[model samples]
Target: MRRFLASALFLSSALPVLAAESKGGFPPFNASTFAGQLFWLALTFGTLYLLMSRVALPRVGAILADREAKIESSLAQASKAQAAAEVEAQGLEQALAKAKANAQAIAQEARSKSAREIDAKRSAVEKELAAKMIAAEASINETKTKAMANVEDIARDAVSAIIEQLSGKAPTAAAVTKAINAARGE
Candidate 1:
C-alpha cells in the first residue's frame, strides 16, 4: 500500500512535466506523451488491482461466506423444525386413532351389555306372563265346569216342571240325568 501511494505521488508530481512535453494536442492522443500515458495507465490499473485484491475483495468474500453460512444454518434449522412437526403430527394421529378404537370398543361393549340385560329382563317378563296365563286358564276351566254343572241342574228342573205341567208327573233324578247325558251325545 505504501509503495502504491509513493508511485501515485510521483506520477502526480510528473504530470506537469508530461503536459509540458505535449505539443499542444489532446494529451492522451499526443505521440510525444505516449510513453508517459502508458506508464500512468499501468500504474493506475496496478494500484486499483492491488486495492481490490488485498482489501475490498477479501472483505466482500468474507461477507459472502458469512451470508452463505447464515443461509445454511437457517435451512438446517428449518428442516429440523419440519421433521419435529411431522413426528409430532404422527404421534397425534396415532393417539387419535387409538382413542377412536377405544371409543368404538367401549360403545360395542356397552351395547352388548345392554343387550344381555334386556334379554334377561325379557326372559323374566315372559316367564311371569306365562305363569299368569296358566293360572288364568285354570281359573277359566274351573268357572266353565261350575257353569256347566249349574246349567245341567237348571235344565233338569225345567224339564221336570214342563213334564209335570203337561202330564201331571215329575221326572226322577236318575232319569233326568240319563236323558241329559244322552242328548249331549255323551
Candidate 2:
C-alpha cells in the first residue's frame, strides 16, 4: 500500500515535467500557460509543505529531541563523574596529609626517644669517668703520702751517715731528726 502511494505521488509530480517536454518549451517561462503552471506549482508546493509539516518534519524534530536528551544525559553523567573524582581526590589529599602528619609525629617520637637514650648513655659514661678520675686522684694522693714519709726517714739516715763519716763517730737519732727538721723550716 505504501509503495502504491509513493508511486502515485511520483507519477503525479512527473506529469507536468512530461507535458512541458512534450510542448517543446519551458512551461514555466511561457506566459501563454501562466495560470495553469501557477496552479500546479501552488498545488505541488502545498502538498510537499503538508507532508513535511505532518510527517517528515515531526519525525526529524523527534529525532533531534532524542539526540538532545541523550547529550544532556551524557553531560550530566560526566558532571557527576567529575564531581565524584574531585571528591575522591580530596579524600586522597586528606589521607595523604594525615599520613604525613602521622609520619612526622612518629619521626618526632623516634627522635625524642633516641635523644633521651643518648643523653642517658652520655650521663652514665660521665658518671663512670668521674668515678674513675676520683679513684685515680685518690691513688695518686696515697702514693704521694707514702713517698713523703719515706723521704723523712731517708733524710735522717743520710744526715747521720754523713756526721759519722766526718767525725769518726755516729750521730744520735734525736740529733739527726732535729737537724733535718730545722733545715726543712718545720
Candidate 3:
C-alpha cells in the first residue's frame, strides 16, 4: 500500500513536466488561418479526446470501479468488527453487574450474621451481670447480719461494766432491762 501511494505521488508530479515539454517553444497557433496551425491543434485535441474516451478512459473507469468495490468491502468488514466488539462489551457489562450484585448480597449476609452474633453475646453478658449483682447483694446482707450480732454482745458488756462502776456492783437482770428500756425511751 505504501509503495503504491509513493508511485502515484511520483506520477502526479511528472504530469506537469510532460505537459510543459509538449508545448515547449511551439509556434503560436493562428486562429485566422483555415487548415493551418489552429486547425491542427483542434484536430490533435479531438483525436486525443476520442482515443482517451474509447480506450484509456474505459480502463481508468474499470480501475476506479475495482477500487471502489475494495473500499466498500473493507468498510463492511470494519462495521462487522465493530458490531462484534459492541456485543462483547455488552456481555462483559452484564457479567460485571451480576458479579457486583452477588458481592453485595454476600456482604449483606455477612453483616446480618455478625449483628446476630453480637446480639447473642450482649444478651449473655447482661445475664451474667445480673447474676453477679444478685450474688454480691446476698454477700453484703450476710456480712451485715454477722456484724449486727457482734454489736449486740459488745453493747451488753459495756453496759454491765458501767453499772458496776456506778453502783459498786453489777446490775441485776431486771435493773439492766429497765436501764436499757429507759435509754431507748420505750
Candidate 4:
C-alpha cells in the first residue's frame, strides 16, 4: 500500500514536465512526434528503472527486509513469553491442587483425632461416674447397718425402763431377756 501511494505521488509530480514540450509548441499527434515522445518516455523509464533496481530499490528492499526480520523476531519473543506464562499457570494449578489435597488430609486427620479424643473423654467420664456410684452404694449400706444397730439398743433400753417403772424394781436378767425377746416379735 505504501509503495502504490509513493508511485502515484511520483507520477503526478512528473506529469507537467511530460506535457510541457510537445513538438511545434502545441502540435497534434503524428507518427514521428509520437515516436519521439515514446522514445524519450522509454529512455527515461529505462534509466529510472536501472537506477531504482541498482541503488534505490536495493536500499529500500534492505530496509523492508530488516523491518520484517524485526517483526518476526518480536513475534517469536511474544510466543515464547506466552508459552512461559502457560507453563507457570500450569505449575500454579498443580501447586493449588497439592495444597488442597494437603488441606483435606489435614482436615480428615483432625476429624479422626477429635473423634478419638471425644470417645476417650466419654469413656473416662463413664468410668468416673461408675466409681462414684459404687462408693455411694457402699456408703448407703454402711449407714443402714449402723442405723439398725442403734434402733435395737434403743428398744432394749426402753423396755428395761418400762419394766422398772411398772414394778418399782429392777428386773432380773433372765426375765429381762425373756421380755425383750417377746417384745421383739422373735
Q: Each candidate's TM vs. the true structure?
A: 0.56, 0.63, 0.51, 0.58
Pairs with backbone N, CA or C atoms under 3 Å apart (clashes), candidate 1: none
Give the best candidate by lDDT: 2
Order of the predicted models by TM-score, top scorer first? 2, 4, 1, 3
lDDT of 4: 0.88
- Looking at candidate 4, the ten consecutive residues that score lowest on lDDT are 22-31
Instruction: Report the alpha-carbon TM-score of model 4 versus the true structure.
Output: 0.58
Q: TM-score for candidate 2, please give it.
A: 0.63
* Cα lDDT for residue 142, candidate 1: 100
Residue pair clashes in candidate 3? none
Error of 3 at 43 (Å): 27
Positional deviation of residue 55's Cα in model 2 after best superposition, in angstroms:
8.4
> Per-residue CA lDDT of candidate 2, range 72-140, in tens?
999999999999999999999999999999999999999999999999999999999999999999999
Model 3 misplacement above 4 A:
1-77, 172-182
Q: At residue 151, what lDDT does model 2 achieve?
A: 90
> Deviation in angstroms for 148 in model 3?
1.7
Worst 10 residues of 3 by lDDT: 23-32
Q: Candidate 3, residues 18-116: lDDT per residue as tens digits?
A: 668765322333334546766798999999999999999999999999999999999999999999999999999999999999999999999999999
**Candidate 1 whole-model C-alpha lDDT, 0 to 1:** 0.92
